[model samples]
Target: MIEAQGLFKRYGDKTAVNGISFTVHPGRVTGFLGPNGAGKSTTMRMIVGLDTPSAGSVSVNGRRYAEHRAPLREVGALLEAKAFHTKRSAYNHLRAMAATHGIPNSRVNEVIEMTGLGPVAKKRVGGFSMGMGQRLGIAVAMLGDPQTVILDEPVNGLDPEGVQWIRHLARGLAAEGRTVFLSSHLMSEMAMTADHLIVIGRGRIIADAPVSEILAGRGQLRTRVRTDRPSDLLAALRGDGTTSTFLEPDLLEITGPDPRRIAEAALRQQVLVYELTPLQASLEEAYMELTASEVEYSSHDLSLGPPAQGVSEGSRS
Candidate 1:
């Protein structure tokens, strides 16, 4: 597991990361999410000992990354895929990294096959495509067979197949009881891949919870009720804090009341209820609602033109 307590990082007068604390447990994929300039990379860098923390502590498997005799075997990270020498062949690169801790050459070949880099293992890093480079980077990270893995935007330049491969790889790593912590801007992918979520904004932790709990707690519960008697049901359901909207002649979307209460009201008024389905908020919607105010940058229009008129045919010509 990974533990961070009161972690902070500052550069001169600017604070990149404020006091934040969170734990990433093993046997689960914990997704780190944030908008641009939200200090995600900075925190990841601190975890791997690439950046010095101004205050507080972060440790992997009960020890700071630098304190480990074989740091790579303790924590495998792909902070920057392009940090490798561009002129080196993918095979040689992994060989060099493995040589650091006296890892065997056979282990390097195993990771190459595992990451689907066997075919291009002999190709130079500079000639590899973005997706190939990402694969190579992952291969290097897995070379040490670490217990804790950290990947930043692993699917940034991947195709659909490559993205799916990464999703499976992360879950597989966690299933083996390895701590998997990753950051990505893809909400849909994160929703499908992550078992838990950690959201950060403005140099501070905003939310840290299970994916299901975050979805259930961020927004009000809504229900879709289809009844034959729309008007009568609407009246019977009318009360303080209750709201209803008609999607069609017989379909009603309701908020501020549980499905059981709605059914009770319908039965009390002798209304015919055909269907009642609870509608839970999606992860994307919950994320937006939670981070709406925490966003650091927003667009605003400053133009003072007379509300530009529609273009005419002559203007198009």
Candidate 2:
């Protein structure tokens, strides 16, 4: 359970994060997504007390991170991978951090094992690979067993298996009623790992809603209708609530109408209804539609409709 309200951050004249609000609910993974320089990291930093917001506040389980009795146990964050001293062994580094909060060495070992770093527990962190470093960061995040877990770019350098592991891990944490917030640029990963999505662009939130809602709002619902009497089928559904585009001789792509209705019209008109299928939109397409205008680097043509509707909601089946 994490809530951010009217968060604003400025660096001189440039605002890294504008007034944005979103909530990370328990028992589900909420994804934070945006293009580069979109202030995702800055927002996360403010949540963990690393940077104070200029306007609003961020709370974890109804309390600011700084006000928690044991902040580590209340919120565990993996903002950076391999943040420990390079020369120190992973076990020793964890042990040292555990000492600050009176956590036992046994807990340290448990976390080490939990993160699949047992073989490298005694090894120096400097020699660890990027994947290993990511694993170590996850280990440290779980060291305190916090109720809310915040991970920024958790799969930055992870291999395929490591990425899948992180997905499962995020889901498992949420299943336990813990708040899991993950930020990533990979749309496919977010599609698989998150139940809700919070998208930001130019330091402002573009969309904050359920994953299905965000995808549906992009309006890519198109159905392919194959019938003997294509003209009649098109005429029957074209008038009031539908937008039909004839692609081929016998194929009509219909939007704003369900497949069942299209089939019913064909059957009533004595037309042979060959096929009717609904098309689904990809998360990548939805994300691109939402952030196309706010992206900092724009090599693609922006003359398209609203920059956000460059990819029209026409489905091909």
Candidate 3:
């Protein structure tokens, strides 16, 4: 497991990470999400000892990452795909890393195959394509077979197949009861892979909960109820904090309660509910709603009308 307590990081007079606290437990993939300049990378860096926290504390398992005798065995991280020496072959790089922690060559070969880097294992790092480089980084991460795995934008340069591989790999590792903390800007993939979520914004943690809870909280209730006794059901549902619209004589569209709660109220009033279907907002929608105020570098539509003052068309380019 990973834990952070009142964590804060500052560079000069600017605070990159505010006092944020969160726990990433084992046996599940916890997604770390945020907009640009939200301190996600900085927080992740502190977790793995890449950068020190200006205040508070963070630990993997029960100790600081640097305190572990075999740090690589405790945590496997893929922070940068192009961090290795460009002249080294993928195979040689893994071998060198394994040597640091007494990991065997067999493990090196195993991770190479696991990451689908076997075909280019002997190729120099500098010559590999982006997708191939990502695979190599993953192989290096898995070399230690650690209990905790942290990946930052693991699918950044991946193709569709490579992206799918990363999703499966993260889920597979979590299934083994390992602590999997992943950071990604891909909400759709994160929604499918992560069981829980932590959202940071403007250097602070704004939301941290199960993925379902986050969606349910941010999304309007989308329960369609068809009933015989509409009046009685509406009266009962009014007390349950629902805004309803009559779609027909017997159809009700509810926007504040789950189907189960609606059912309970219908049952109490002896109303016959013929249809009850639940729908949810997409993860991307939920993320936009949650981080509506947290984005630091938000984008807007480009001005198409005319050039600005003192700026020529060629000068703008």
For model 2 the TM-score comes to: 0.84
Please identify model 2 stretches exceeding 4 Å from their true place. 225-233, 246-252, 264-276, 301-317
Mind giving the per-residue lDDT tens digits that candidate 1 earns over 1-317? 99999999999998888999999999999999987667888999999999999999999999999999999899989886777798999999999999999999999999999989888889889988888989988888898999999998899788999999999999999999999998976677789899999998868899999988888797687899999998998788788588888999899999989899899999999998999999988888888877666665533343733224422222212
Top model by lDDT, which number? Answer: 3
Ranking by TM-score: 1, 2, 3
Best-first order by lDDT:
3, 1, 2
In model 2, residue pairs whose N, Cα or C atoms come closer than 3 Å (at least 3 residues apart or on different chains), thus clashing, are none
- Model 1 earns a TM-score of 0.84
Query: Which residue pairs clash in candidate 3?
Result: none
Q: What is the TM-score of each candidate against the true structure?
A: 0.84, 0.84, 0.80
Clashes of each: 0, 0, 0
Distance from true location, Cα of 234 in model 2, Å: 2.4
- Cα deviation at 4, candidate 2, in Å, is 1.9
